[model samples]
Target: MSTLPQIEPTGATGEVAELLAEVKKNMGAVPNLVKVMAGSPALLKGWLALSGALSDGVLAPAIRERLAIATAEFNSCEYCLSAHTYVAAKVAKVEATELEAARDAKSADPRAAALLALSDAIIRGHGKVDRTVLADARTAGVTDGEIIEIVGNLALNILTNYLNNVADTDNEWPLVKPRTHS
Candidate 1:
């Protein structure tokens, strides 16, 4: 059970209703995360806005999804892990091996591996990543723009991961649990 109420789209009104409608139209369904976020219209709106902006960012959709998976695993947020796993496969078309690799903050692609390593470092170090990781990322052709976007993506995923963990949010997608819990 969720610690927070999962606002049903049918029961929502005003801004909440409109936001849910937009989410449904875009995603074909209003996920539990958005439903829970609907409790605070401001939060829902901000999440939507940031998510929308990031979709148009420099990082590829696959990379963004990988980052989400890595963050979800590190935070032990099953809701985010499941949701991002579904999105990574169905929407991003990431390979199954790649999806599994992401959970470990790794990739077969050198650039992607570098990004994942940086993401892992950021999560483990609490934003105080070592210079060598940044240097390695740049060596792997991760541009300054991509690096900034990586931080943005990490922030976005961490927000959802922390929220889901706190709320014990119900997972609507196919469940994907973390390999280890902190």
Candidate 2:
């Protein structure tokens, strides 16, 4: 039900084709979001570069996925929620309960819990988390490097969330239905 068409890697030409190939090679498939983003070659390349750059950041894969899940949940992006949930469980090896906790923006680990709380505060405060929250995160063992990476991860997830929302990106991964709170 996406407003944009998903481009098949084989059908793409030039840079787009090259980028799609790399994506497939790395991801084992061209996710629907990437396909839709292929409509803008620059976006496709930039997204890939940003994602690649973050792969070696201070944060662990599980932590990154956790942040992604929480951010996606906050944004109500079903596509991202579904995709990251799959990534978290399969690629990152996050526990099922941890995955659920991430989607709820809560973590059992003390440091992770502090970081998640800060993430929520940032989201709710429109990226202006108060001084006390940041200090609390530092006290919880979140280093400066990790804090920077956390912000980067948040920005990345927000970009994907916005793209999925605007494009109505179709889910190509196992579907993760949004949590309903009555």
Candidate 3:
């Protein structure tokens, strides 16, 4: 059987565990991705720190999660889609059906559908978003700064999704409802 590629740790000692402990201080549990990537506590810590900052940033919770889930889905990273979908439901309290539909559709909230479509556009590439798309996005309430932030958010998801896919990180904990879906 084939397996995923993972960068093994040369040596992980109490330090890795300490990083886990630190992460737990903020979050009740260090997510499985963090644990596996903890193969290098520094790497794990960096990802967690950056993730934490983005998550806690000025962006609205729903918006951040919308971008994350959309990116994960477009990338076809099942693991990431599951993980972020759960966070969106649990931490962000976003409705599950809505999140699911948003992941599958270009525009989640039809009202902001045009602006919302930008996440997918970033994943596909700038070409997917032309002058007309920009105009539509603006009409849908997206701003220049938000467009830039959306790119950053999608880039972040691409990083984490690729990392998780490579690690084939075990689903150490249960995901949110309907856990088994693709």
Candidate 4:
């Protein structure tokens, strides 16, 4: 059950129909989050636009998926956790152990670990991270552009996480429960 109505692709019309069509074309299905977001076509459009732009960002797909997993876990948004976990594993080819590690804002790779740490700090600190966090990420070889993209990815994940939390969006992907409540 969801607090918000999940707009059915079959019933959509005009801009909403076109947007849903695009989502389906790209993803092969209309995810519940996107369907719920379709309640506001503008919001759905904004999400699609940002997502498209971020796909061209310097961060690799695996890193982006890991960030989404970490953010979803932090927010205790089961919908996003499940969705991202599916994509991380099936599409990004992230290892099972790495997916679990991401839930704790951790990674085996030093560079990824640094970014996860920064993401955790940003979420916990509400964007006012300590200087040492930035220093650590730089020490791990994260460039300024990477840092900016990290923030952008975090923002994108947060939007979906918060939306699902508020909507109590039903999980359409394989369920991946959050280990802790935020």
Candidate 5:
């Protein structure tokens, strides 16, 4: 039971059309992923609300995307990795080099490097971390507040990462750096 759904555009009316409108009004287009999720009206609505709220969270847009990419990468969720990598580069201003490093485990940005490490630790189910990781995070200017937010943000990505893995959602090519093939 893959997550992808075959949609009938004409079938979209009433509640479904309204939902599509909501997406289009905000995103200028309704993404295929959202349309697939919309198969369950409640799920579509639930994720939409969560997305809206995440949009308003204290984390910078770039950091939020970074967390998402790291989680997806660690989970080996190509679906989420492809999607967020695009957003990170296109909308969130994440650098390609940083994203590549994250994928290859060679991250360069100190703050993002710390986050990539944290993401790996969490994904690998590491029992504990050395004090130096925390020290690195501090030196990278990641506040305790940000750390808490990172955990919460990573949780959000975990949900979607797992969903996408289970779903087998079709790839949407990179909108950021053309031909880079993230």
Candidate 6:
């Protein structure tokens, strides 16, 4: 059960309704997370603006989706993990093994692997990443623009992950359990 009211598009009015309409047009449905966010019209609008802007960033769609999953897994946000896993498989066409690797932040592609490592470090370090980490990403051929975009994407995931964590949002798709380590 969501801690916040899940505002349906039909029930919403004004800015909230417009935002829900946009979400439906873009994603084919108003996801429950978005519905929860709709409780605050400003939050929904801000989320949509940030998401739309970052969608045009330099990262490939699969890589972005993979990062989203990795962030969700790292944060133990079950809602985001399940949602992004669906997007990764159905929308991004990421392979099963690749999806698993991505969830672990260990992509097979060297460049992607580097970015994933940086992303994990950013989360673990709480954005106080070490200089060596940046150096490694650069050595792995991550450009300045890519690095900025990586942080942006990470911030985006953090918002959704934190929101889901706080809201205890119900998993609307097949549930993805948090990855356990030995």
Residues 1-182 of candidate 3 have per-residue lDDT tens digits of: 11432333233357786777776677776676666777666677777777777766556777787777777666666667777777778888888677876675444566435545767665676436677777877887777877777776776788777777676666643443332233
What is the lDDT for 94 in model 2?
92
What is the TM-score of candidate 4?
0.98
Q: Any runs in candidate 3 off by more than 4 Å, and if so which?
A: 1-15, 106-112, 126-128, 173-182
Predicted candidate 2 versus true structure: per-residue lDDT over 1-182, tens digit per residue:
99989999979999889889999999888989999999999988888888888988888899899999999988889999999999999999999999999987899999778878888888878889889988999999889898787888888889999999889998878888777421
Question: Over the full model, what C-alpha lDDT does candidate 2 score relative to the true structure?
Answer: 0.88
lDDT per residue (tens digit) for residues 134-174 in model 5: 67777877687776666677767777766666676665645
Clashes of 3: 0
> Model 2: number of clashes?
0
State the C-alpha lDDT per candidate.
0.93, 0.88, 0.67, 0.93, 0.69, 0.90
Q: Rank by lDDT, highest first.
A: 4, 1, 6, 2, 5, 3
**What's model 1's overall lDDT?**
0.93
**Residues 1-182, model 4: lDDT tens digits:** 99999999999999999999999999899999999999999999999999999999999999999999999999999999999999999999999999999999999998889888998898899889888889988988989998899889988999999999999998888999999897
Clashes of each: 0, 0, 0, 0, 0, 0
Question: Model 5 Cα displacement at 56 (Å)?
Answer: 1.6
Query: Over all chains combined, what TM-score does candidate 5 have?
Result: 0.77
Model 1: per-residue lDDT, tens digit, 63-174?
9999999999998999999999999999999999999999999999998998999888888998898889899888888899988888899899999999999999988889
My TM-score estimates for the predictions, one after another, are 0.97, 0.95, 0.77, 0.98, 0.77, 0.96
Write down the TM-score for model 1: 0.97
Q: What's the CA error at residue 22 for candidate 1, in Å?
A: 0.9
Clashing pairs in 3: none
